[model samples]
Target: MTRVYTLVNQKGGVGKTTSAINLGAYLGVYGQRVLLVDLDPQANATSCLGIDKRSVRTGMYEVLIGAAPASPHILHNPRYKLSLLPSSPALAGAEVELIEVEHRETRLRDALAPVMDRYDYILIDCPPSLNILTVNGLVSALNGVLVPVQCEYLALEGLGQLTQTIQRVQKSLYRDLKLRGVILTMYDSRTRLSSDVVAEVRKYFPGQVFDSLIPRSVRLAEAPSYGQPISTYAPESHAAQAYDALAREVLVQDGIPTPAFETTR
Candidate 1:
């Protein structure tokens, strides 16, 4: 069974793309075949994986509009040993184009159906805003959503609106849609604000928060510039270890046996 999860959060600059990329890489390191779907029009996830958006003739935009097949858009990230459904700037127009289309919300779900069994996990990196594209991501994720919340002031600001949106989707679209877990990212232990935010989020969600918190690291921020995941860019960094632990937690949550952690050092 493929575990499809949308890394969603309406708030921007919350490490959604970073988490999606590194988490999928670590999952692949743990021997799970992972597919990362870049649903954001910004195409950060696609470019972060070393794929040039300008050179991508076909991507999620083409697939969603029925102009191309999903398989052809799928690109392999050799460094991470994972697959990616690249996104391009043209995807921004898809929101308006899909508005009048029949079953627009499920277009992504339908597009991914043929390749669902080809990977052990399918992770979608959603845009910051809750738009039609984000809705498509939520609809395609049958398993649930993995939220990356940054540890800072106003960290929980838009979470309520996001939860309400998810509830609305669950009520009308996917009943099984769930809040898989909350991932605390860019946590700085030296700052009091970081600790307070983590405590508050844990108090709010309780067991829904993952045990592994991603620490603030320069390597994490720099990895994307090099078009590689933290596992490949700075394997010995704390960010890499945190994501590795996160991969184990994800498997354990799904009742899949977690393998022993192997240091990327």
Candidate 2:
């Protein structure tokens, strides 16, 4: 059984793509068959994976348009057992076109069904919006939805909107959709507000929050520009180390035995 997760957040620049790329990479390194779908029109995940955006003639766009299949568009990552269904700018147009189709929200769900069982985990990198594309992702996933929340004062404010959307989806669509967990990103332990935000978020979300929090680091911001994950771009950076811990913790929670790694919990 494959567990599909979508890294989603209505707010941008909160390290959503960074978590998706690194988590997927580390999951792959940990021996899970992982597939990362770059659903963002910006194609940050594609570029961060060393994929030239311009050279991508077809990818998520075609998959959504029914012009090409996902499995065929997938490109394997050499450093990990993960694969990528890279996206391009063309995905922007698909959002509008998808509206005209029947069961538009289920298009991606239906497209991914035939190939879902092929991997242990499939992570969809949804764009920073609750649009049709995001709806497609939510409808397609099995049980997991990994939300990346920024560690800031107004962090929890926008979460309500996403939760409402999830509620609607559950009521009208995917009943099995699980709130896997929320990973705090750009956490600055130095900021007292960060501490307060965490405490407050935990107060509300409780068990829905992930144990691993991604710290803010310059390396994570630089990785996508250079087409590499933080682990490969700045292996010694704190962000890389944190994502490694995240991967370990995720696997541990799944009851998978890891060789030798201590998660921060």
Candidate 3:
């Protein structure tokens, strides 16, 4: 069975896209047949993978609106078993068109039905909002991981709205949807404020938090612009190693063995 995981957060520049790209890449490097679905219309994930958005003909937008099939849109990367269902800016229109459709939340669910058994994992990189497209992603997710809390001043504020959305989805729709865990990102270990934010998150999330903390690094911020995941672009960077560790933890939590930690970075 394919474990569908959504990397979602309402915050921007919190390393959400970075985590999605590298985690999916390394999971493929670890021998899992992974399919990365970029649900973000920004196409950052697609670009980070070296796939030009302009050349992408069929993507998540077409599939969700019943304009394309699931298989043809898959872009295979030469370096690994990972394939991608890239997204385009057109996906932003889904939020509005979905209003008049029956079972709008189920559109993505139905589109993914046939391909569920073909991969070991399906990673959905959601956009930075709790809109219909995200709802569609949430409806189809088995579990979700959030990249959050870059500081302490406004630690985990406005999270109630997101949790409420998830709770409501579980109550009346996808009862099986689960909050997999939270990974703290962009922590400047030199700051006491970073420490306070982690403490605050742990109080509410408890054992659900990942033990690995992602430090803010220039290498991470620059990797995407070069059209490469941190694992491939700056393999010796701390951010790369952090994501590799994260990939290992995700595997371990799923009852799969953790891969060897990379030390070069």
Candidate 4:
């Protein structure tokens, strides 16, 4: 079965895009067919994986507005064994363009339907705000939502607002929409603040929180500059280990087996 999940947090710098890229990369490393949809207009996910967003003329924007087909817009990265539905700055205007379209909220779902069965996991990396684009992501999330919460003071507040948004989406948009899990990101074990934030988040989400916590690492931050996932940039690093573990947890949740495998360069 194909599992579709949207990584949403509304608040930026919470490792939402990083989680999407790294987690999806790890899933691919584990022998699963993975497709990462870069729904953010910023196109961080696209650039993070080494695709130049500046040159992407027709991508997710065209797919959403019915200007192009989803499959052809997909860019494959053999390095990570991942496929990306690249996004561009053009996607910034997609919301306004889609407003007049019928069933705007389901545009993503509709566009992704034909290719849904082509991959084992389709992870949508939503923008940092709750806009029409995010709404489309929420409605298209057939599996559920995966929120990456930063380990900081205001983490709870942001999560609460996102939960409310999820509730609203559940009631009005997609009833099957539910929180798949909360990923604790940017964790600094040396700081008491990070510890407290993790405890509080786990307390609130309880069983919905994943055990693998992503640490604040310099290497993780620099991976995107080189346009590679942490798994390929620093496979032996803590950040990679954490995301790999998180990917395993996600696979387990989906009743998939995680076999011991190594990436070939």
User: Which prediction has the highest TM-score against the true structure?
Assistant: 1
Q: What is the TM-score of each candidate against the true structure?
A: 0.97, 0.95, 0.93, 0.96
Question: On residues 1-265, what C-alpha lDDT tens digit does candidate 2 reach at each position?
Answer: 6878888888887777889999987887788899898889999888888888878998998988888877778898777567898999888999999878888888787878888888888899988899999988888767678899899879887788999988899999899877888898899999999988888888989888887779988888888787788777887888888888898988878788888675433
* Model 3 pairs in collision: 236-265
Q: Which candidate tops lDDT?
A: 1
Clashing pairs in 1: none
Worst 10 residues of 2 by lDDT: 256-265
Q: In model 1, which range of ten residues has the least summed lDDT?
A: 256-265
lDDT of 3 by residue, 73-112 (tens): 8888867557889988888887787798888888887988
TM-score between candidate 2 and the true structure: 0.95
- Model 1, 142-236: lDDT tens per residue? 98999999999989999999999999999998998999999999999999999999999999898999999999999999998899999999999
Q: Which residue runs of candidate 1 sit more than 4 Å off their true CA positions? A: 261-265
Ranking by TM-score: 1, 4, 2, 3
